[model samples]
Target: MTEPVLTVTSLVKKFGRVTAVDGVSFELAPGASLGIVGESGSGKTTTARVLAGLEEPTSGEVAVAGEHVRGRSRRARLRRARRLQMIFQDPYGSFDPRLTVAESVAEPLRLHAPGPAADVRARVDALLDQVGLSRRAGDSRPGELSGGQRQRAAIARAIAVAPRVLVLDEAVAALDVSVQAQILALLDDLRRETGISYVFVSHDLAVVRHATETAVVMRHGRIVERGPTERLLREPAHPYTRLLIDSVPRPGWDLERLARDRRALDAL
Candidate 1:
C-alpha cells in the first residue's frame, strides 16, 4: 500500500473550556480527496487549521509527507508550510487589499523561491492561467474582482507553491450556486492534473458528495462516522450522520415525492 501523504492521529484541540477537536484521526493517501462535513461550530474548521499547521494541537500528531508538524522548530515549520497550503473561507479576507491578483499569487513563490524577478512573474502568470484566470487578471486588485474571481485568484495562490496537500476550509461555501459549481469543477480538474491531495472541509453534504470520494462526518469536535461517500450517504451508520444527510435541502422534494422515491428505492 502507498503511504499516506497526510496523516492525523488521535488529534485533540481545546479553546480554553471548549474542546474544539477531540481525538480526530484520519489519513489521506497521495492525491486522495477527503471531505469533512459538519454543521457550524462542529470543529470542522479547527481540524483543518490544525492540519494546515495554522493552530497547534493540544495533543496527538499531524504529519505531512512523513514529516511531523507539531513541536517542530521554526525552520521545520516553514518547511511544512512549503508543502501544505490552506484556502480560507473568505478569499477577500485572505488576500491583501493593496496587492494585485498577480502579487497575491506570486507571494508564496517569492517566500519559498526568491530568484530572478522575471522568472517569478512568469510562474505567477502560469498559475493564474492554470486557475482559469486571464493574464490580464494579474494586474487587477482583489477589490476589483467578483466573488468567484477572487476565489479563483485565492486558489491560484494556494497552488502557486505546488504544495502536496491543500486544506480547503469552507472554500466554496460563500459562492453562489453557479459559481460554486464552476469552482468545484476547476478544483477537480486541478487535482486530476496535479495529483495534489485535498482535505476539503465543508458543511454542505451535497457539495461534498459531488467533490469527494470519501466522507467523514464531524459533530461537536468528534468524528461520528466515516466511509466511502456513496455508502455513507446511502446508508448512514451513525445518528449524527443520518441527521446531516436528512438535513440536506433537496429541491422539489415534497413529502409526496420523498415518499415515492423511498418506495421506489425500497422496490429496488
Candidate 2:
C-alpha cells in the first residue's frame, strides 16, 4: 500500500485552560482528499493551524512526508514549508497587500526552488494559468482582486513550491455558492494533476461531501464520527453526526429546535 503523505496522531492543543483541539488524529494518503468537518468552535480550524505549524501542538505528533514537525530548527522549518503549505480562509490575508498576485505566487518558488529570474517568472506564469487566473488578475494586487480571484492566487502561492500536502482551513467558506463550487473543482483538478494530498477543514457538510472521498466529523474538539464520505453522510450512527446533517439548511429546517438539540447534546 502507498504510504500516507501526512500523518497526525493524538494531536492536542490547549490555550491556557481551554483545550482548542483534543486528541485529534487523521492521515492523508498520496493524492487523496480528506475532510475535517465541524461547526464553529469544533476545533477543525485549530487542527488545521496546528497541522500547518502556524500554531504549535501542545501534545501529539504531526508528520509530513515522513518528517515530524516539532522542535525543528530554522532549516527544518524551511524544509517543512516546501513539503507542506496552508491556505487560510481569508485569502487576501495570506498575501502581502503591497505585492501583486504574481509576485505573491512567485515568492515560494524563489525560496524553495531558486532559478534565473526569467525561469522563476515562467514558473509563476504557468502556476497562475494552472489556477485559471488571467494575466490581468495576476498583475493586480490582492486587495484589487475579487474574493474568488484572491483565493485562486492563494492556491497558486501554496502550490508554488510543489508541496506534497496542503492544509486548507475553511478555504471556500468565504465565497458564494457558485464561487465555492468553482474553487472546489479547481482544487480537485490541481490535486489530480500534482498528486498532492489535502487536509480540507470546513463546517459545511455539503462542501465536505463535494470535496472529499472520506471525512471525520468533529464536535467540541473531538472526532465524533468518521468514514467514507457518502456512507457517513447517508448512514450516520452518532447522534451528533445526525444532528449536524439535520442542521443543514433545508425545506423544513427549524433553527430553534436544532439550537436546543445541540445544546442538549453538549450537555451529555
What do the candidate models score in CA lDDT, each in turn? 0.89, 0.90
**How many angstroms is residue 32 displaced in model 2 relative to the true structure, after the best TM-score fit?**
0.8
Q: Which structure among the candidates has the greatest TM-score?
A: 2
Q: What does the lDDT read for residue 28 in candidate 1?
A: 93
What overall lDDT, based on C-alpha atoms, would model 2 receive against the true structure?
0.90
Residue 40, candidate 1: how far off, in angstroms?
1.6
* Poorest stretch of ten by lDDT in candidate 1: 257-266
Error of 2 at 184 (Å): 1.1
List clashing residue pairs in candidate 2. none
Estimate, for each residue in 1-268, the C-alpha lDDT of model 1 and write its tens digit. 9999998999999999999999999999988999999988889999998887788899999889998877567887778888899998889988889999999888889988898999999999899999999877779999999999999999999898889999998899999999999999999999999999999999888889998999899988999899999999999987667656765667754666555655664465
Off by over 4 Å in 1: 251-268
User: Which pairs clash (backbone N, Cα, C closer than 3 Å) in model 1?
Assistant: none
